[model samples]
Target: MRQGKVAEPVGAMVIPAQRGGVLFAVGGLNGELYVNGQALTGQWAEELRKHVPELSSDLDRLQAMRAEWLDSPPQDRTLALAGACTDRNCHTTH
Candidate 1:
């Protein structure tokens, strides 16, 4: 584990089944949320929220969107995330 980081195994939870076919797991590291090894934004909007409730509604929404994009061809995934970031003003540098 990384310094000042916490990891929670989401393996027991079935992501795809619960979130419209998006497979992912939640992990907390350095007060951050990671889903299936990738850092999550909408799911981890706040650091404090990480220790509290499950944020199921937001998670479901993000997961559904992710599933929709993942269902697209590999080359399209980048485009999808990029578009989302732009729309959300995330300003991700990629």
Candidate 2:
């Protein structure tokens, strides 16, 4: 009999939010938030509202905050995202 490769359990799931506008990391020991390839918000901050229809106030707030932050034109949005990932205590190796 042939044996199939055992599937490893996933520590987290990356969910698409807002038609792939953002990605959320859930089901891990620590929750994290990312946007446009950048980690700009935290999970505890309720940034997942962007995906929820009923509780969207937090999403609106995030948009407004992002707008203001972009007004200055971040020197490097990619770096910012990387920094956020690190700030959120996400392991890059995974």
Candidate 3:
């Protein structure tokens, strides 16, 4: 209930490869964001959003990638979509 504290485990999806440690939590207050116990400012979230849009379209792509990871072994194809995102202006065709 305190400010900047995440009290509950909402939902989490693990990214693959270099980003495998990322976590996502919905239904919680817009409190401080953290990955592996390090605190992050809201700006960090905003920056990530800019690179990876949270829109349903983008998420659908990620979901598909996750599904593909289940049977076939992970490949460069799975990482092509998001792994290439480096600049702040990187945008995926939706």
TM-score: which is higher, 1 or 2?
1
Candidate-wise lDDT, in order: 0.37, 0.35, 0.35
Candidate 2 residue-wise lDDT, 6-89, digit = tens: 132113223233343333322111222223233344552354454444424434444444554545535433333333332242
CA error at residue 29 for candidate 3, angstroms? 31
Candidate 1, residue 14: Cα displacement in angstroms equals 24
Clash pairs detected, candidate 1: 5-30
lDDT of 1: 0.37
For residue 72, what is the lDDT in candidate 2? 50
The sequence of per-residue lDDT tens digits that candidate 3 reaches over residues 1-94 is: 0123346422322332232223332222222223222333344444544544543233444444434444452333323444523334433322
Model 2 scores a TM of 0.28
The CA lDDT at 15 in model 3 is: 33
- Residue 43 of model 2 has an lDDT of 52
Instruction: Give RMSD to native, each candidate.
Output: 12.3, 13.5, 12.9
Best by TM-score: 1
Report model 3's TM-score to 2 decimal places: 0.29
